[model samples]
Target: MNLQTIGNAILIVLVIGWIGYRQTTWRPVAIGRMYRLALILAIVGAGLLVQQSHGLTGLDVAVLLVEIVISLGVGAWMGAIARFRPLDPPVRVGSSDQVARFASRTGWWGLALWLVVLAVRVGIDVLATSLGAHAATSTGIILLLIAANRVARTAVFAVRLERHAAVTA
Candidate 1:
């Protein structure tokens, strides 16, 4: 394979490995860790995407918007289905009352949902290759989608937690 292909493969591997690590566990993620993960994604995503941005057209922009909308919906769904639990006496990472309140839920449905969404992203790569649509930039688009999904998922979870917290308090 060419060097670009190899680079894309490496990037996808990192994405998969990161997501897989998150999926394989059912523990309350530290607030610090979540922020760090988001920052990492953002940095990696932007660094890689900048090189690919030159080829994008109006049509590509529209398609990317639609994809982002769909990804946000998927993320909201994932957050909704997560099983959230409040820690008694709260495990504080700081002085704040927000003691890393996160879902530690696990099961088949989450796995299925993640896999289906992932498959759709992979499908984008396949379509881009088949149609000869800026093949070099396709991986960047896919990686950005992954980053978007992660940030969106976290936002949705936090929002839901806020609403629940408001009710409980």
Candidate 2:
């Protein structure tokens, strides 16, 4: 199998193991694992476009490095935002006042981060294309869309999962 397949497999296992462990002995450690997986995914995703057509110039290389840093920084920020007191077996349902406040803060920050990333990408694209310097590499837009989608989905999924747990309780 290819490296991509191997990496994907490992990631899936990590996620499953984290969820299972979270239900058992060490929820905090499982949360840590989930954040680690996010970081790993961000790094892997930053390099999704590798081809002759997407060859990086010196400026493009610098931009890519910056993007990687930003991506990891965002991942760290998300992990921090997600940190909360452990839930008891009798799962709490709906939006707790505490959770609502957390969501507002977290959601605003997450939105701001994505906006900054998008702005940087657009700025770079304008600079590169305008100067006719390096127009080959073009993964930024697609990755930005994907990151936005994933972040939104994560928030929604977390809420839904909490609701389901509450119902089952």
Best by TM-score: 1
lDDT of 1 by residue, 17-69 (tens): 65656665665645455555666766776676676566665556665666667
Candidate 1 residues lying further than 4 Å off, grouped into runs, are: 29-36, 52-54, 92-98, 135-138
Off by over 4 Å in 2: 1-47, 52-54, 78-83, 90-105, 133-137, 140-169
The true-versus-predicted C-alpha distance at residue 17 of model 1, in Å, is 3.8
Residue pairs with colliding backbones in model 1 are none
Clashes of 2: 0
Per-residue lDDT of candidate 2, residues 9-34 (tens digit): 46435643443343333232232233
- For each candidate, give its TM-score against the true structure: 0.74, 0.43
Colliding pairs, model 2: none
